[model samples]
Target: LHGCSAVTYKLSKDNTTCLIVETTATASVSYTNSNRQKLVATWPLGEAAAISGQCESETKGQASLNLTFADYWVHMSFASSGGKASLAGIELFVTVQNGSRFLSPNSTGGLLLTASPKLPLSADTEHFACASELRLPFGQPGGSALVLSATKIQAFGVRNGSLSAKFATCALDARSSVPSDSTTAPSNTTAAPSDTTTAPSDTTAAPSNTTAAPSDTTAAPSDTTAAPSDSTTASTDTAAPTNGTSTAAPPTSAVPTTASPEPPLLNVTVFNSARVPCLRLQLRASLSILYRLKSGGNATVKVALPADTKASGDCGNSSQTVQLSFMQGWRSDLIFVKKASGYALQHLAADYRLSPALFPNAAEPNANRSAFGNGTYFSVASGTAYYSCRSAETLRLDNFVTMETRDLRAQAFRTDNSSAEFAGSMEQCLDDTPIDNVVPIVVGAALAGLVIIVLIAYLIGRRRHSAGSGYQSV
Candidate 1:
C-alpha cells in the first residue's frame, strides 16, 4: 500500500498467498568506443550508490514508480484496464554533464528512451522483460539500447492486505550490431522471377514473326507484275512520307514539356483573436520520427506533410489554438496564451497514426495516439522572418517520442498584405533565453544590497561610539 493510496480496491480473500508488489531496482549503462563496434565501458547508475525511489498511484487506474539516480532518472508507468494490468510506458532521462559516465565525452545531448511493448502484459506472469534500441540524435550507427526486466511481479495495486514484491532492472548497452543490407536480397529474388517470365513471352512472339515472313514471300511476285503502275504513283507519294516523319517528331517532344513545377513545402493562413485572418505562414522542412523496431533496434520514419496541409487558429489570444491537420491521421495543435511580453506557445499536442507497412517491426501500437508537451516561452512571435536552416531540431512530447525537423524556413506575415515581406530574422523560437538564467543575477543583486546594509550599520555604530567617548566623562 506504499503507493496505492489514491486508488480504492478490495483485497482478495486468500491471506496465505502473499502478492509481491514492489522492490528496489537497479540501473546500468554501457557506452561504445569511437569505432562503434563494441562497448568501451559499463557503469552502474549513481556510481553504485543508493538512489531515491518513490511510487505514485492515480485514480484512473494508472500508477508510476520513479527511480532517481545521480545522472539519470527512470520512470515506469503501469495501468490496470479491462481486468488486466500491464506496463504502459517507460521513460529515461539522462543528464550529460562535463564528465558524465552515462554518455560519451563529446556527446552534446543526453539519451532519452520512450517506448512501449507491442502487446499487453498480464499479472500472472513470473518474469517480464522488454528491450528497445535508442538512437542518439547525435551518434554513430549501432546506437544505444535499453532493456527492462522484472521478476516476481504480481498485481499493480494491493490485492489484499499485502503488497506485491516486484524487482525491476534496467540495462543500457551501446553499439549493438545493426542489420543494414538485409532488404536488398529480397529485391534481387523478385527481379529474377520477372526476367524469367519475360523470356517465355519473347519466345512465343518469335513464332508469329516466322509465320508472317512466308506471307511476305508469296506477295513478292505479285508486286513485280504491278511495278510499272507503282512507279507512276511513287513520284507523288514522296512528299507524303516527309510529312509523316515530321509529325512523329512533335509528339515525342510535346510529351515531356507538360510536366508541372514543384510546389512549395508549407503555406497556410492563421487567425487572430477575432477569428480573422492575421498571419500567413510558409515554410519548408524535412520531418522525421525516431521509432523503436520490434527486433530491438531503432530506425527513422520520415513524414512529408503536403504543401496544402490545413491550418486553423488564432495568434495573439489567450485561448488561441492553432491546428495543423496533415494527411494520414496526423495532426498538430499549438495552444497559445497572451502575456505581458507577447503571445507564447503554452502547450503543443500532436497526434500520429502508425502505419504497419512503414513500421512492420514497430513495438508501439498501430493506432492514433496523442502526445502533449509543454512549450518553451518566447517560441512564438508575430511578423515574418527567415528562421535559420541548420541541423535537425528535435521536439519531444510527453510520450517521450521525438519529432525532428531540419532545413527549416518558416515565416509569418499579416494576411492583409499582398506579399510576404519582413527583414527580421527568427532565431528565438528554440534558442530563446530561458527564465532560469535570471536567477543568478537576481541572487547577486540581493547579496550586494545585504552587504551595503551591513556596512552602513557598522559605520553608524563606529561614529556613535567615538562621539560618546569624547563626551564620556559626563
Candidate 2:
C-alpha cells in the first residue's frame, strides 16, 4: 500500500470509529501553447503533504472527512447503514499557481475531479478496491485525467467502546486470471449433442408419411377447377372492400399529420471592439410570461418562438438584435449590448396573443411584457469559457409580473484561444434588485431613530435643571 491516510472519530464517550485509505493517485493537465502545440504536466499525490484535516457531520447524518494539502484539497464523505460504511462522495481540487504554464494568463485555478460512486467496505476481507480512471472536461479534448489504482479501503465499526484493526487482503490483483462462467456455457451445450444418437431414427419415419400424402392429393383435379369461381364471387362483394379501405385511410393520414419537425437552434456570437470573438450563445428560443386571467387568478404561459427569426447587427458594434415574428401577429426581440470590458444582455421584449381556449372567461388576452437589466459583464481574458443557466431564473419586469428562462449556454473567446478555457468556479448572472436589501435597511433605520430620541431627551432635562438653579440663587 502507498499514499495511505487514516482518520478516527469519537462517536460517543467510549465508542470510536476509524477509516483507512491506501491508494496512488496522480493529476495531469493538458493545454495548448502559443505556437499551437499541446503539452501536459503531471503531479503525484505522494509528493504533496497533508497539512490539515477535520471530520464533520453532513445534513443526512453522515460523516465526512476534509483534508487540505499544500496545493490541493480532498473531501470524502461516508454513509453508515445496514452494518456497513460506504463512500458516498469524493471531490478533488487542484490549484494552478502559474497560469502561464498552460497558456492561460488569466486563470485562477480550477476543480480537477468531482464524482460520487457508492463503494461499500468489504465485510469479509475488510477492503474495497477501485479499477477505473476518472476524467475531467476542460472545454477541449484531453483536458485532464486522474488515475487511482491499487486502492485498498477499510472501515472499522464501533464495538464496545474500542477499535479493531483486523483486515484481509483484497483479491483484485488476481481477478484477471479467473475465468468467467459466460464463456464456458456455450462450449458445454455444444458438446452434449454428440451423446444423443436416437435423434436420426425418429426423423426417418416422419419423412416417409409426408411423401405419400402429397402423391394422393395430386389426383384431386375436381377441387382445383372450382377454386377460381369461388374467388371471383368474393372479389365481386363491394360492401366488404369499401369498409376495409375506409377504415385504413384515416390511420395513414392521422400519423403524418401529428409529426412536426423540431425547431432549429439559434446561435448568436459577439465580438469586441478589436474584432476579436468574445462571446457565443446557442439555444432554442422560447418565451415565458406571467399574466392574469378574468377570474383574478395569475398563471404563466410559455410560447415557443419561430425558427426563422431575423438577425441584424454587425460584430463589434454597440448592440445586436434578434427579432422573432410569429404568424399569429406576435413578435419578440432580444438585445445584447457591448460594454467597456466585456458584453451583457440588455433587454428582452415580447408581444403575444393567448389562445381563447386557455383563457375562455378573459375579456382581453393580448398582452406585452419586457425585462431590463444593467447587465452583468463577463470577460474572456480571465480564463472563463462557458456560462450556463440550467434552471429557471425569474426576472421581475415589475412588481406584478416576471419572466423565466432555462437551459441557456454562453461561451467566450475564439476557438484557438487557450486563455479562455474553463477553470475555477462557474460564473452566474443574477438580477441585482434593491428589494433584496430591504430587511437590512429597515433594521439600520430603526436603530438610528432610537439613538436620536435618547440624545434629545438627555439634553432637554439638563437645560431645565441649569435654568432653575440660576433663578434660585438670584
Candidate 3:
C-alpha cells in the first residue's frame, strides 16, 4: 500500500493466463513478459479505460478489477495520474498454475502469496512457488521473509552458491487458510515446493578461535576467531586524526593487554573411504563458539585431499581454497572438480539429484517430484555436485549436498496437528560417505591361500613318494 511511486507485482516465472488486481486507488496498470519487457498498455485504453471505471473509493478493499495478462513476470505497475499513487491495499491474483505457488516479495520484505488455480488447493498435489527475481535488499537479515497464515507450505530460499530466487519443499499440508487476495481464489493451497534444494555442509571440526573472517560479503562469513593469533590481535577501530594527519598507535608494550592464546586450525580430515577414489568428510560444528563475520557468517570446514591429488571443480572455483557462509539460501559450490588426469568427468556426472533420505519415503513421497509441507526439515540428498568427470580412473565424487533452514525452525500448521522436526544442526553436512566395497577380497584371499597350501602339500607328497625306497629300507 505504501510504495515509492508505483506498485508492481511479478506474477510467476511461468506464463500467466489471468490476473486480478485489487487496489483502493486509481492508477495506471501495465504488463511485462517473462523477459520483463513491457507489453502494450492494456489496462487504461481510450475505450477500455472508460469502461474499466474510475476507482474513487477512499475505503480499504473497495475496488476489485480483473485483467488478463498471458505472460510471465506480469509486472503490474500502478501509477496515479496525479504524479503520486496512494493505495490502501492491493492484492494480485494470477491464473498461471504450473502446479507451483508464487510467494512474491512485498515492498515490506514480507512474502505476498500469489496463485494460479487459486488457494486452498489439495495437499496431495505438488505446489511450489517460483520467484524468478525475488531477492532481499543488501544488509537485510537472512531471516527477512515472514511466514503468514496464508503460506501453507514451508518456503526457504535456495542460494545454489548463488543468491538465486529458488526454494525446495518436502511433504504436504495439514491446515488451510482462506485466500484473501481474491474472492475466486480457492483455499488450502498449502503444498511443497517443486524444486529440490541441496543442504549446505555442516561446519565440522569445531571452528577455531582464529578462523578467518570473510572480506567478501557475497562469500561465506569468516569462522569465529576466539583467541587472537600471535601475528594479529583483534583491535577496535580507532578514530581518525584531525586535519588529514595520521598518528601511529602506541606499540604493544605501551598498552597493557591480555595474552589470548591462539585458536587451533580446523583439522579437516576424511572420515571414511573405499578402494575407489571416493571419500567422505564429516562436517562438524561447535555451537558454543559463535563467530559473527561482517559479510558472510563463518563455519569451520576442513578438507583433506589424497596424496599428490588436488581438488578441481566449482567447489574450488575461486581457487583450490573456498570459503563457505551459512546465510539463508546461501550455498557453497560443493561438487568437486576432477583433475583431467585423475578422474573421468562423465563418471562423476549425476544421473539425477535427490532429496536427502534423512526423512521417510512418505515424508518426501516422490523422489522425482518435490512438494511443500509444514515443519523445520533438513534434506540430505544426492545430486550433481560440483565435480564433473567422463569415466572411471577419473575423479570420483561422493554425491552429497546439505539443506537447512535459515531460522532453524519448523512451524506447525494451525489447521493440522502435523509438524516436522529433525534433530541435528540446521547446518547439516551431506558429504558423500563411501560405501564399503562389496568385492569378496577377504574371502578370495582365504581361498587363494588354501589353494597354495594344498598344492605345496601335493608336491611334497610326490617328492617323498619318489624317494620312498630309502625310508622303507630304513
Candidate 4:
C-alpha cells in the first residue's frame, strides 16, 4: 500500500483490469484524475454484505479482479479495510482471457507479495445484501466476473459497472463469510447461495460442517440448488432495489453559481421644450440623454436631429455612428428651427479625436475655436415623436426633445414605440416681439427730437432781444 491504507497507481490509459490479491478484509477502491485533482469513482467494498468480499485465494489461487472505464485516466487508488488486510500484489493489463497469466497471481512477472499468506476467514455472519456503497465505475462498463464452483461455472453479469443478478450473491458475501479456519476451510464453500434465507441455514450447519472435515460435503446440492432459485429471484426482484438505488443517485437539478449575462437596453424621450411660429424664430434646443451597458465595449451610436435644427457641440452626425466607449451618456445644446407645421434640428458633427461617453460635460462657449481639437462627439440613437412650432419667449418647454435606447448593440437608440404629437400651431417661423411694441418705440423717439429743435430756436431769439436791449444800457 502506498499510503497508510491505500495503494495509488498511475495508468497510461483507460479500460484497465486491476488484479489484486486481497483477503476477506473489507476495503474501498477509488479512481481519481490527477490532472484535475478530482475524485472520479469510489467503491466502498465490504460495507454491505452484497458487493463486498474477497475470493478464497489460499487453495483456489489468487483472485482475478477486473474494472473497466470509458475515458483514460492517469491515477487510481485502492484502499483496504484496516482489519487484517493484505494485498499480495496487483497487476495492470488491458484484457483478460482464459489461461491468461492475469488469471493466476503466480503466473506472471509483476508486482506481487513475496509470501502468499492464507488469510484467516471472517467469523462475522451477516445477511448477503447489495452493498449500500456499491457504485458502477465511470463510463458504465458492463463487464462481470463469474463465481466458479469446483465442479461447474456460473455466469454473473456486471450491469452498469456494478455486480448485478447472480454475481451479487457471491460478491456480496466475500467479506462476511470469510472462513475462520483457513487451513481446513473447504474450497467448495465459495459457491454458497447469497440470499437472506440461505445465510441462516449455513450458519446452523457451520458447526457441524467444521466437525465433519469433508470440505466437498458442505458444497453439496444444498447451496447449488438454492443458488439457481436465488438467481431467479434476483432477476425478478432486482427492480425494487434498483428503484431504491435511484434515490441515492446524484441530484438532477443544481443551481448555477454564476449569473447569466444581460444584454444592453436602449431608451429615448423627446420634449417639445422650445416652440416658435413659422416666421424663422430662433428656439433654444437642448439634447440630453443617458446611455448604459452591462458590459464594457465600443459602440457606434447616432442621433437624428430635426431637419432645420442647428447643432455644434455634442450631438454628432444625423446618420453616422460615433464609435466610442460610450458607457454612460452625452449632452449638448441644439438650435431648434420653427418651420411650417413642425420644427427641425440641424445635423450635429462628430469629432474623431475624443472619446465618447454618456452625459458628457457641456462644452465651454467658443471652446471649439481653441488650438485643442473639438470636444468628444456623442450621438443619440434615433426614433422621435411629433415636432411642433409655436411662439414662445423662452425655448424651455418641458417635453420638446425626448429620446430613449433603441438598438441593443453598437447604438443605444430609442425603440420605435415611443412617439408624441405636435401640440404647437402650424404657423411658419416668426419673430416673437409684437409689431405694436416696435411702432410705439419709434414714434416716441421722433417726437422727442422735434421738441429739442424747437427749444433751441426759442433760446436764440431770446439772446438777440437781450443783446439789443443791453446795448442802450451799456
Specify the highest-TM-score model's number: 1
Residues 1-474, model 4: lDDT tens digits: 111232221111012212222222222111222242322221222211101111222113222222222110011112223221222222111111113222222111101001111212121121122221221221112211111111111111112322112211233234555422222334434333333112211122111000000000000000111111001000011111110112112222221122112112212222111221111112222222111112211111223222222221111111111111121222222222222332244212111111222212212111111000011222222222222223321221111112221221112111223222222223232342246777888899889998999999999998899888857553
lDDT of candidates 1 onward, in order:
0.37, 0.38, 0.21, 0.21
Q: After aligning candidate 4 to the native by TM-score, how far in Å is the CA of 303 from where it should be? A: 5.8
List the lowest-lDDT window of 10 residues for candidate 2: 209-218
Candidate 1 deviant stretches above 4 angstroms: 1-264, 272-276, 377-392, 406-474
Off by over 4 Å in 4: 1-286, 290-438, 472-474
Q: Model 1 over residues 189-255: C-alpha lDDT tens digits? A: 2111111111111112111000000000000000011111101000111111110112111111111
Residue-pair clashes per prediction, in order, are 8, 1, 48, 51
| Residue 433 C-alpha lDDT in model 3 | 32
Candidate 4 C-alpha error for residue 362, in Å: 15
Using all chains and alpha carbons, the TM-scores for the candidates as numbered come to: 0.33, 0.31, 0.19, 0.16
Error of model 3, residue 201, in angstroms? 44
Q: Cα miss at 328, model 2 (Å)?
A: 65
- Per-candidate alpha-carbon RMSD to the true structure: 33.4, 35.9, 26.3, 38.1
Judge candidate 4 against the unseen true structure and give its global Cα lDDT, from 0 to 1.
0.21
- Point out the higher-scoring one by TM-score: 2 or 4: 2
Candidate that beats the other on lDDT, 2 or 4, i.e. the better one? 2
Q: Candidate 1's C-alpha lDDT?
A: 0.37
Better of 3 and 4 by TM-score: 3
* RMSD to native, candidate 4: 38.1
